[model samples]
Target: MAQTKNLEVWLRGPLPDMPPLLQPIAHALLQAREEVQSFMQDFPEELIWERPAGVASVGYHLQHLAGILDRLFTYARGEALTDEQLASLYAEGKPVEAADQVSALMQQYEQRVDRALEQLRQTDENTLTETRRVGRAQVESTVHGLLFHAAEHTMRHVGQLLVTARILREKTQA
Candidate 1:
């Protein structure tokens, strides 16, 4: 009896404008973005930067999520990080005291995710295997690798951010 092999691994498709090979990457990035938005609804802004038990703060995760996508996509394009990007990386973990900082960070994260999706849409599947250099050290990786890592890393940080936000909210009420 011929049976269909595990279909879940090959089911990437249907995301508007995403390349056939890049659909999974786009889907993953969008899923991560939705998770962040869902978990952060009405999250108290005052605790965005409050690290619980020496872990990273929610604010740091938010900033790094955006910055990671931007940097990795830039690498995928075979370009060096610009001076502004370098400065953004330098600022990732620094806390801000501004009242609207959480909203600002959320906006930045969402914008980065949108940009990543657009890049995925425009990518040619033929170039997925082409080598790309990462960072000034010229670390070698393929276009596919960089795009996959961008989605993976964004979800990783979103998980951490959600945990941190929950902990901060719980602590505030205790």
Candidate 2:
């Protein structure tokens, strides 16, 4: 078992290139990533798609985490989802033969986070209040709203993943 470290990503200080107002957003994202990575270390692949207590499986949460971040970041850029993005969104929870491993999913999520952080770096704090549209419904929101949502949503899924992962581990141990 790996020894638990400080757990809080914010204690490392603000991310470079992230705007002041967006520091919390970056902190939340980094925190989620750190927790997810640690919690997933050495996790069994066989249980990735196992649903415990009728809740979503760990695989779904991992895939959704990456997909949601990609979609939210795309919206934050005042852009629409491309066909590829739409396909990815539609396929979030379902398992695929390839790319089903925990490491692959984690790599995808880490890459998405990198992209989101890059977007945050380029975001003009002054424009955070500017209106942005979301999804095919084109719901109204602001840049700040989207960014904050990305962090909170990521954390929410992280929480679910943690619980599910723990349950799976306990079952295996038993």
Candidate 3:
């Protein structure tokens, strides 16, 4: 109990000053990537190689996230992708029955995460104020809005990947 209290005190310290809009989005992106990479590291080779039925396997989720980031990047540049393009992006490097693997998926996802983080870091107050007119989305978004949404999207998928990893681990250990 004493140790726990001391640990809590250490953890609950002051943080450095950061712009309000940039701070949360940056932190969230970093956390999401850490979680995804940590979970992926635990996945066994056999499990990563197998295409689980009726659901996205680890590889699928990683590649899907990479594609989403690319689309978000495109959107940030004021271009909109069609539904077919979005679908193709998600399906671009999927397990090809006899040839695909998880290494490629991890590589793609890591690259996307790095690129998105770079973009997030570059956002400024002016950039945040720049408005973007997305196609029929009922809400116009700014660069900051898109950055935050991208972080949220990555977080959502990271949660799923964590669950998938846990399930695989449990199955293997059982």
Candidate 4:
């Protein structure tokens, strides 16, 4: 996430050590991270949990960005959600005093992205076709499907976060 360049990540070139088939997933995650960083550069602390139109709060999106990655990555590893992970999931939207602040959430988010990228780098393309289970229902998906969904879901949430932040800032300024 410390990448400093004018070009988008994908255009910047292939990520080192990342498998060829997983390159786009890495790019998408990186791009989503950058967008979150940019949009949240000056996001106000007081507005972190504001749900302007009764939709999801910015805080929820931030917590979700990190939590979803952790959950999906855990599934990709052929594992179930640990106690701590399940606890984190339950605490997503409801604020906990100062801990839900923007900086802390962003830090968690950056760390998750870093961990996700590293996992992608270590992912063997040959294993992509192998089936994996998701959530308690144990729904089936391939490694590639799960990872690709992670990227897709990341981008989707980022879009929501960006718009929510923009609306909050604009309304507050006016």
Which candidate has the highest TM-score of all?
4
Model 4: per-residue Cα lDDT over 1-174, one tens digit each: 545498898888898898999999999999999999998897888999899989899999999999999999999999999999999999999875665488889999999999999999999999999999998899999899999999999999999999999999999989
lDDT of each: 0.87, 0.90, 0.67, 0.93
CA displacement after TM-score superposition, residue 64 of candidate 3 (Å)? 1.7
**Candidate 3: where are CA atoms >4 Å away?**
1-20, 49-53, 82-93, 96-100, 135-139
- The candidate with the higher TM-score, 3 or 4, is 4
- In terms of lDDT, the poorest run of 10 residues in model 4 is 94-103
How does each model score on TM-score? 0.90, 0.94, 0.73, 0.94
Screening candidate 2 with a backbone cut-off below 3 angstroms (N, C-alpha, C), the clashing residue pairs are: none
lDDT of the structure predicted as candidate 1? 0.87
Q: Itemize residue pairs with steric clashes in candidate 1.
A: none
- Full ranking by TM-score: 4, 2, 1, 3
Tens-digit lDDT string for candidate 3 (56-94): 677667777787777776677677887875776757535
Which residue segments of model 1 deviate by more than 4 Å? 1-13, 96-98
Candidate 1 C-alpha lDDT tens digits along 55-167 = 99998999999999999999999899999999999999997556688888899999999898888989999999999999888989999999999988887888888888888
The stretch of ten residues in a row with the least summed lDDT in candidate 1 is 1-10
* Predicted candidate 2 versus true structure: per-residue lDDT over 76-95, tens digit per residue: 89999999999888888888
What's each prediction's clash count? Answer: 0, 0, 0, 0
Candidate 2 lDDT for residue 165: 99
